[model samples]
Target: MYSLKLVTFVVLSSIPYFCYGAKREDFDLQKMFEDMGEEGNKMRDECFTENEMSLADLHDYDKAEDIPEKELCFYKCFFQKSYVVDKDGKVIIESIKAIEEVKDLEESDRETFTNCLKEIKPVLECKDMVEFEKCFDQILM
Candidate 1:
């Protein structure tokens, strides 16, 4: 009986191993791009609507010296809002790293970094796994 049980267990384990090694098609890049685009657009629309501001309404500063203390407040608000909506963990990690990066920048550089983050916010909000993988690839690249 013990020998029969061992054989049964070995056969069952082999079945899964065979299934795991089955050939699968390569990832579809076009579908990934489409999904990313769609997720990005939806996130952008929702963010703008919730904040009651158009994308064009984001603060503009002409000089590094021109950034007021209120700009940091805006960054904090944006980070808080965006971080909570991230269903996938990738964006949250990126946002945290970006925040840390911004902390070490000069006033002017901080402004530019923050603006770049704002631009990429929609792309980071993507919750689809395929799109998330694509975004991760792009970030790493």
Candidate 2:
């Protein structure tokens, strides 16, 4: 009976893990942005500025007729590293180690300014200033 109870407890605990790993087919960026409201726009703007690319420029790049394969691959890799998708299709923040490389900033030179790192938690870690803004908006919303 004790062995059976132990097995049951283990199975019960694992159930949450399995359920959490289930793929979410309805992940909506629009809804998330809407949820963020003004804060989302601010974050997006900050991200664009930090990346040195305007929203129009990014849109144009995405809509480019002939984007280089290597560039596309690089973007994919970058997104994957930032987003932290798991084998089970669940997304989580993996690491924010890149934040440590920042140099020569005034008040914003700390580990993470604007609480972006704390906001993303363990699913979408932000490594840099640009990513921090993006993740901050996403988490805030």
**Most lDDT-accurate candidate:** 1
Candidate whose TM-score is highest: 1
- For 8-125, candidate 2 gives per-residue lDDT tens digits of 2232222222222222222322122223234334544454455554433321121122333332232223333334333332333332222222222234433343345455433222
User: What overall lDDT, based on C-alpha atoms, would model 1 receive against the true structure?
Assistant: 0.33
Task: Give the poorly placed runs of model 2, Cα more than 4 Å off.
Answer: 1-36, 60-141
> Candidate 1 residues 16-116, lDDT tens each?
22212222221321122123234344544454466564444433333223323343223223333445214423244444334433345466655543444
Candidate models: Cα lDDT each? 0.33, 0.31
Q: What ranges in model 1 sit over 4 Å off?
A: 1-36, 63-141
lDDT at position 78, candidate 2: 31
